[model samples]
Target chain A: MVAAPCCAADDCIIEARGLTKEFSGFVAVCNVDLRVRRGHIHALIGPNGAGKTTFFNLLTKFLAPTRGQILYRGEDITHAKPAEVARRGLVRSFQLSAVFPHLTALENVRIALQRTHPGTFHFWKREATLAVLNDRARELLELVDLGAFAAVVAVELPYGRKRALEIATTLAMDPQLMLLDEPTQGMGHEDVDRVTALIKQAAAQRTVLMVEHNMHVVSRIADTITVLQRGQIIASGSYAEVARNPLVMEAYMGAPDGELRGGH
Target chain B: MRAQPVLYSLAVLFALAVPLLGIYPVFMMQLLCFAMFACAYNLLLGFGRMLSFGHAAFFGFAAYATGWLVSAHGWGPGFAILAGVAAAALLGLVIGALAIRRQGIYFAMITLALAQLVYFVCLEAPFTGGENGLQGIPRGTLFWLLPLHSDVVMYYVVLATFVAVFALIRRVVHSPFGQVLKAIRDNEPRAISLGYEINRYKLLAFVLSATLAGLAGSLKALVFGFVTLADVQQSTSGDVVLMTLLGGTGTFFGPVLGAGIVVTLQQYLSDVVGGWVTAIIGATFVACVLAFRRGIVGELTLLASRARRTLRPARG
Candidate 1:
């Protein structure tokens, strides 16, 4: 195998160089180069079908890139399995809320933490052995403001709480770089604000690369913003700088004259 | 949940009383064997969400192995049964490694194809006796001391094995490993994102299920004193699937209940209706799929929960 060329600086937690994904004849993501610095809320924003999700998939190793490499802490992880990548402290949440529907909210988080304990593969061990993790799992649930609903089954929880549970489960993994795909996709204004604040709080000690359609959530929490148009990076900088770029405005609104709006 | 232990004790008492109640020991033993088989199958299909269409490959193969060891090689029943379980587990490892690469219908198809391959191998293999199968197998002494020649003795042994294996299955279902299996079953992609090596967990579940099924098959061979192509036939696979679905797929006691119903219908109805037992079973399975999609136990549990909810409206 050929060694990936090193391009990221020491502080860069993840770097994508010349990443391209082609499904059959059509290109989904094309030659995207990006870097996420440590402990920064980096948001990848774009209109529908602009390849933001595809790029995120490539970074998380959900989709193998056709061309180019992904480096985590300057180590090439382009061909790693999704679980292996996650085990290396790069966990991701889905566009849809992905809690185990039959499990309680606390049990859903406990599944993530169970791997850290012994006998995760021991069928002979009693499930009560996992009770040791309950305190810690409850702590994580409380972290996401789901403390009261810990005993509730995940499917019974309301829409936004399910997303909160997903985040809580993701947090249980203790990832260094968390990839969230549209954390606030379908929510009321109140839920969107709560999740936005939750995301900001989650990004306190880790790097977050998120694909967000909601510009308000992006403008509020995203420290750095990368805008994609037709699978190519149109602008990459602070949210204010990317919002002021004319190409991003044209991509969002189809008119080059207007400024990129933050709310809604 | 609090009523579970009492229910279990009553079930054990009933099983014990069945022999003293003048029911044929051999028939009850057969029911217990099939019940064990269904429980093992449930661990995969109900809990792991893996539909294996070729479980008879393990079931029939283990029976043949035990029959050959006891009749041809003069092996003790215990060693023969252990060897049979080992053979089935080995087959499970090979099949699971290949089949888990796909999902849904493809996975089921792969298992079916591999099981057909095993069936053909058994048919053509020299020691399997092809059409005649391994017949006139001895009941031989258990551990070369405790005689299994008596029907009543063998019945107790089978019941004990059934009870132990059932408890083991329950233990496996409630364990941390079982929790992970449930998570994988519920959502594979999310489990993957959570850093679970899901394929390994799935493969382990398959092998364990297969091993337990083999235990049932080996026990059945000892009870019948013969191993035939019928044990490994495609219809046997279908019968297990029908039994599991008729009882309940995911519930712990569902498969056992299903196996009991199917086995009883086969034993008693065969004498009355002859070959129409097959047609009756088929119709029952169809009715089960249509009327109670959750299977008997699953629907009952739902109703009981609903009843409790109605009774305790103040809690809400």
Candidate 2:
């Protein structure tokens, strides 16, 4: 029950001190000391099996870290439930389970707003009370450029629109720090651009820590970048600095033999 | 949607005319009780997406409670029924807490095992009468004022209770909490990440479903003047599942229709085919699964929407 040591820097919203996760004998995330500055877009990029998702899971409390502590806003939330962490305004948009498919885009966002609403437990209240949230849900949908699909079920929307709807739902939670895992995975060039724009707009008012395979989107939007290899942080600095780092180049291209290309 | 109210009114009018046409009132009462049981099961299966194989634990336990109060303690029908419902809801809370720890098929299996445990408890318990059950329980008047000695009066009372409970179920389905329940059903992880303590919502829905099932069970005890171990048996649980699946899992009128069809088939089939009644029901369930996976009402909705689509003029 000891409190985690807080960072002296006032801008550090999230600090992970030697966070490690092991499944049986093999380590998935190893002693990764990390700091995420407030109101900055932080990107965690790694090759396949580098444990970016495993690390994200630990920070979100979806999985208990095998070792070390996680500090959120200077408070130790290492043992909190996903819902408890979310209630404190640190929320996550999952890979696939980020949106309710059967619910319409508007209804999906409405449920997020309803979570923080006082009348969530009022089963007997008139539907009018719920109708009052429609305007705000629609506003979020518009923000994600999903205004036309407001009435469509999340499942019926195209893959990119589904991703947009997920973002809208996450935005409805009004989170202080939004953790997005693979925000642009499996997308066409157009969708990747659209989601990249959405992420940039979202990061304006809140901190975002995203794990992305598409380094182009990350380089464009991320203010700070942390690169991992073999479950260990290889480099941590500004996006330009991480991109130019020889270690990161070696991890992505098998060896640091040539200059980095194509991602720009 | 516009045709819904007209359809509902017609159905109510038909229910009223059944007893007057000299149809057996007791048979109709059984249908009402079973219909309510299926609706309660449907609440968990259709909306919550949590299949509970042990719902008979709630229905059967309440029947025994009502039977004991009326026959042994001389309690009035209203108070006895209320007490039975409260006990069943408490049981639901305990069972739901345990069962919700698992997901999918495991949840169903856990509920089934717990229900079997309850069955054994009823078999060994003293006041349940084990094999004999509580027999010849009196159907006391409502509030001790209206006389329920007449079959016609009892028919009206059961019908009234059925309608009130049906309205309650309808209210819950359309409410905001119901929206949250549907969201949980569609995706549990998303609901949790949205900051909903989904286990609480699941348990609340379970308690409400159990309470309604209890109401149906208590009513059945008064109507038949008996409670048997058969009421709480695993077979009874299967019957409710069959009725719900046959009617349509998520539709409003599906369970009622399924209950009516199953109850009538059982009654007349037992008179003629005797031991083949189970076989006949088994065949019907197989047919339902193979030919009409969406059940009766679900098919009707599909057809209606199709018809509307065809009737509309094609846009240029």
Candidate 3:
């Protein structure tokens, strides 16, 4: 396989200005501004209640932003439905483990490929795109190193494998921007590092904005990091710079450098 | 070992055995109608994981449309069946588009309410022949003179329709579209994130299910030479769901077996228990729900999987 030509153009692929999300007087994300450039693996890190997931929901149109403007490729997408937003080359993975549990991993990828191309209502004649579809799905599964388990039911996979399959399935759509919520949520250190590497590989072709809590993983994979606290951006900078920020320290309960136990 | 061809042969042998056994043709025709109904209903429930509560709207509505087409305009049975199927497809399109606005229990309720509305429409429509229904209809031939009046021939006809529709469903469930429908059922959010227009797939599934149910109903009316308000009744809808669920929700051949069992049980119970048949069917539904959520086919498949594993060495 050829390497994806990395084109970190530094132009904002996703721009959020004054974004806010509230539910019945509870502010989940408040007045946050974020800019993610094309082909950059950006990470958002915060404490449990920092509203990273809420912000992701807003950006992907899973939930309505209380108030904000989300510009993707310089056009507004603040109010588009999830499908419409996805059709515009923006897709998101779920934080709480979203996947088709019954389908095989390869089948899952194939279905995603099928959805991307023509619909499945071809009532007569063989689907002309079958060979290409199968190959594309196979290529994605191999990228995630899930080629061995391609025919295994996704639900039957180990947690790490399932996470990898989730990422693989999303990547098969060839999105211009990928929003992943907690991609390494329950992974072991080795699995986390492996997935972080895989995420970097995927980011070679498109922009990747991820939500995470592991500082070391963030440091290794993210070109830039945003720290949020109480639904607000507390700090934003390079990994080394954010590590020294006093606000980042305070947000991590006064632990210097915002490092957690069991972190490499 | 390789049991697929043997199983296929067995199924074919059994289907062909119906005529040789000297069975009553009308009884087989009734079974065939319900079989198609269960299979079409199962297309959504088994594969789509959507248990529709108002299938009668399609089944009975098509029956009425077919009755109207044949009696009012003196159309042939083939054209009547086509008109009924078209009407059912349109109904499925409208109802599926609306019902899919929500998922889970809400989807079922929305379909039921829409079916009730259809029931009310049938009640008021002048062509429906009111409560007495459109009776004295001719049991028209297939095309011109296939002579559908012979009981054995009509029985074979019904059987053929049942087999074709069932095979088509089997073909569909294994197809890419079916794979996506299953994926959507298992995880809607993941499917949408993967770029599926979730509602469109769902609506198309609904329409397909509705149209096939219509085909079965249209054929049933032709075989019996009568259509009535009972076809449009709410109970008719509930019966199809019960039939599918009782046989199996996830298995391909489950609905076929389910419809056969339920119809046979109805026939046997009518002879032994008379008016208490409905109560018996209701009791069966409750039993199946409580004890067999996987239904007969799913449970059998589960058992087969378990057996396969047991016969093999454990993998580390």
Residue A181, candidate 2: Cα error in Å is: 1.2
Instruction: Name the TM-score of candidate 1.
Output: 0.97
Question: After aligning candidate 3 to the native by TM-score, how far in Å is the CA of B255 from where it should be?
Answer: 0.7
Model 3 chain B: ten consecutive residues of lowest lDDT: B1-10
Residue A162 alpha-carbon offset, candidate 3, angstroms: 1.1
Error of 1 at B232 (Å): 0.8
Kindly report which residue stretches of model 3 are placed more than 4 angstroms away from their true locations once superposed. A1-10, A125-129, A254-264, B314-316
Which parts of model 1 are misplaced by more than 4 Å?
A1-8, B314-316
lDDT of 2 at A160: 90
TM-score of each: 0.97, 0.95, 0.93
| lDDT of each residue in B186-269, candidate 1, tens digit only | 999999999898999999999999999999999999999999999998889998999899999999889989999999999899
lDDT of 1 by residue, A1-264 (tens): 343344345578988889999999889899999988888999998888999888888998989999998889878899999999999999999998899998899999999999878888999999998999999999999998999999998999999999999999999999999999999999999899888889899999998999998888888889899998889998999987998899998888888887887788
What DockQ values do the models have?
0.86, 0.68, 0.50
Error of model 2, residue A105, in angstroms: 2.0
Which residues of candidate 2, in runs, are more than 4 Å off?
A1-8, A259-264, B310-316
Ranking by DockQ: 1, 2, 3
Give the C-alpha lDDT of model 3.
0.84
Q: Give a tens-digit lDDT track for model 2, residues B1-316.
A: 7789999999899889887788999999999999999999899898899999999999999999989988899999989999899989988999899998898899999999999998898899999999999999988787978677788889988899899888877878778888899899998877888888889899888888988998899999999999999999999999999999999998889999999999999999899999999999999999999999889998998899888878776641
Candidate rank order under lDDT:
1, 2, 3
